[model samples]
Target: MGGSSDVSRRRFLQNAALSGAAAVSGVGIARRADAEGAGGGAGQAVDPRSTEASGRVMNPIVPDFAGEYGGKVPEFQVPKRPMGKTGLQVSILGMGGFHLGSAAGQKEVTEMVAKALDHGINFFDNAWEYHKGMSEEFVGTALKGKRDQAIVMTKVCTHGRKKDVAMQQLEESLKRLQTDHLDVWQVHEVIYYNDPDKIYAPDGVLEALTAAKQQGKVRFVGFTGHKNPLIHLDMLNRGFAFDTVQMPINAFDPSYRSFEREVLPVAVQKGMAVFSMKSMSGSGEPIVHGALTPTEALSYAMTVPGVSTTISGMDSMEVLDQNLMILANFKPLGEADMNALREHGKQFCDGRYELFKSSLKYDGDLGRQQHQFPTAEEVPA
Candidate 1:
């Protein structure tokens, strides 16, 4: 098990003290059973992708939380939507696993998991390379006993055409997540031009994924790429059945490479559930740069037609609360409003905004020490 550094340990103790006070003040946290159905009964390990399985009732948001938005606030439960033709019904707002591990400590992450389940958000996203596996480790710890309350998805970063290398990564991910099987396992960051050919090659990662599926280690398969919609389409074009497809869904997507325009329809045609990420322009910098308010950016992603869930990395309680607030009051933008937002987005859609596409910063590098992919003998025939 990965141990926290000295600084992290101190932070954990401090945060734990604060949490105890918060609990005493009546913050309205439901216990495991009432809030999340932790073990048996409502929380019994049903399909992680389905919300109806929990059978929890959504209470309406009290008027005090309405804030500046006047009039009746919508009911408060996180909404669930169908994921393509897959029998999974995912929560519209998913917890980004990368950020979960970035929390101050294990206690904080555990609290976030509990709170997210309490708020009805069930989809969680992670990747093997995130924080060098620390992220998955923390997620595993946080979800120690409440595994059934959330749909956990993680990715293997190797771009290898080798099944053994990919399978090794999958096994490592499973161990770190402390789960026997994953709800979803994805091909992470398919940004390079030849990624699709490599993935579809003989003895490729796809073969490994099929083998894992046959072994019941994974329930669903999908891929995520933000650099280009063409790459996303290429993966789809290869004719493999994908249960989910994740990409950037935001105010500016329609103006740039436009995953919404070039790829979303194709995924829909293939009956793949759409997962949205980078709504706040990946780093939340665009909001600071005045592109759009945080609420507007998030709402923009949530309203895109056919999106099953939009994931934002939440490392703090304040951010989680703010996002939940946005979801609680969300109303899809009308066509005219969407058009206007797109026009506003046009000014900022230049490649500079989406660095993951224009640069290699976000690419998953397994490092030189690891087995380099496409080894001479492993190359596609």
Candidate 2:
């Protein structure tokens, strides 16, 4: 087992302290049952306090894992939604494929994949260049016989007007994933306004993607960017329609660089599936900035409207189980819960983490491309 880091230790102590306080104040934390069945319309009002008054939150409805893991473990379910316009239903919790390639060994990767499947997660995300393709390889192997049971999404990054290169990447990905086609194939790391034109230009990547879809090599089409929402919106607003979009949508995001206010509403209006990333602020920068705890940050993201799912990177079963508990026990946050979470993270959003707002590290690939094709003087119509 991995040793607890200082941050983990701190989080445990804080949770224990908070639990004790709740006990003394008579504000009981909901057990594991009530949360599963408390369904209301989107944006429905929920009383946060009543959650405690309602007694234990219900445990997630776990599937039978007797022969698989040699025993039973708690199961968690996040809600599900169809990929916009594709009509493909996917879990609200997505498994990020980043660390699956980089940090985890083959056995660990297999176990992680098994655990996620054992739970209700069916949205598996990966990228072509992640761990130089090891991530996709592992996921492909893990989902070998179960391909029909899940939605596999992956991305490919290629340079200007290179449809051939893009197609090649997709073919390689298909080979590694051991699948005939992808459910969703995205143009990865899109960070600037002019990106769409370059992608959709004659002999550009979008042509390859369109070809893939027509040939049944892929199903839904989408894009992911970490830097700016304007860039994302600009890309989507251009002529071609996207089925889904992925961007950062945590508490620190709203006050400083909010995709929720600027881009998400548009996606919702367009009926595109909105997917959230960096809910835990990936590099732990939110924690360094004294923003909300990991759990609180995740809660805030889940509460945002139009978010079909939030992708969290879980490297261990403990992390996975904790997130499962949160999702399974989720009750729509009331005004007070939302206010408290927002207030707690307000100071950290004062542009201090603006590193996340710039594509500096992506300078070579995304930044250079942006320089080449700056957003035209006229805004995208």
Candidate 3:
């Protein structure tokens, strides 16, 4: 009996050694744990694991923005912006997932995703049609086993007032994302005159979205528009509650076609999360006109009140790292930083709204006729 007991103890010790080695090698074991939701629920605090089973190693860097202003960095250095009136707190800098699917390969996509998560970016944005749904796939893979670590937001762009079609699209998105629910589900790519009436018609997209929320498949509902603030406002006022609104909020935007002046305040007043996009002067044109450096452009956007988050397309690891650094070190822009950026960017706004002018690059839905609103002539003038 004593000899048999000694042999069993030796066997158990050997098995334990092998298990520890496998965990250190980053084998499939840790991934399984994460997928099982072993750590915690979404947005729960994370404890960095230092074993090979941790899958990918992430470098966490909090930028020293407060240092530039002669102030001590707060213990919670990353600013949390509220998502509309919902009282959901999100990182001030959000990761734009559109380019992640469109413009990146698997390796680049995975690296970017890991880096963003490491850098405290909780808000992630994606669209169903982006990269033919490759974006969602990449995100799903990168976030595998780590779904509870961040807030995932995605959009759908199906046509018509067909509830079934909308529901199908939503399911497709969920499958692609490998998630049971989304933090925010947005009506993607809204443009001129399509009004809430058409979108929220009898069997409309809103019905599907509301149903999803009720089912715990989505937490919040919102909309995004790159054109016509009036359309955005109309959609908001159309009766259904929206938790968030995304629009073009940039320095050049204020000079012409000012969503900042007209629409942003409305969103803030309505207590909806205000997401800002087109901060790079829409289509990356501002860089050519010497308007602002990429860092300066992001900084300017960060300073805006009611601007919950600024989403930027990060296709490359370098771009991802650069953005992470900027956001990590993000200090609220003072008068000097703000004034200099505005002055430097003034000359670029010479009646050339490239995004609106060149319909080919920006307006992919123009040919569909689904987005068209009634012209003044058709409206019985």
Model 1 error, position 267 (Å): 0.2
lDDT of each: 0.67, 0.62, 0.60
Residue 117 lDDT in candidate 1: 84
Per-model TM against the reference: 0.77, 0.75, 0.74
How well is each residue in 141-249 modelled by candidate 2, as lDDT tens digits?
Answer: 9897888878999987774548998999999999999999999898887765677677778888888888999999998888887777888878877868788888888
Model 3 earns a TM-score of 0.74
- C-alpha positional error of residue 83 in candidate 3 after TM-score superposition, expressed in Å: 2.0
1-381, model 3: which lDDT tens digit per residue? Answer: 123233223322322322322222222111100000001110111122323213321111111221122222222335677677676788888777765654348887777677666666777788776656787888887888888887899887754547787788789999999999999998876764754666878878888888989999999988887756778878877778888888876666666667787888888888888888767644344422222334556777878888998877655554454455455566787765565445444544553533542232344342134546332223343
RMSD of 3: 18.7
Ranking by lDDT: 1, 2, 3
Residue pairs with backbone atoms closer than 3 Å in model 2 (clashes): 30-57, 31-56, 31-57, 32-57, 32-58, 32-59, 33-57, 33-58, 34-58
Each prediction's RMSD to truth: 14.2, 12.1, 18.7
lDDT of 3: 0.60
- Residue 243 lDDT (model 2): 83
What TM-score should be assigned to candidate 2? 0.75
Q: lDDT winner among the candidates? A: 1
Error of 2 at 134 (Å): 1.0
Residue 158's lDDT within candidate 2 is 76
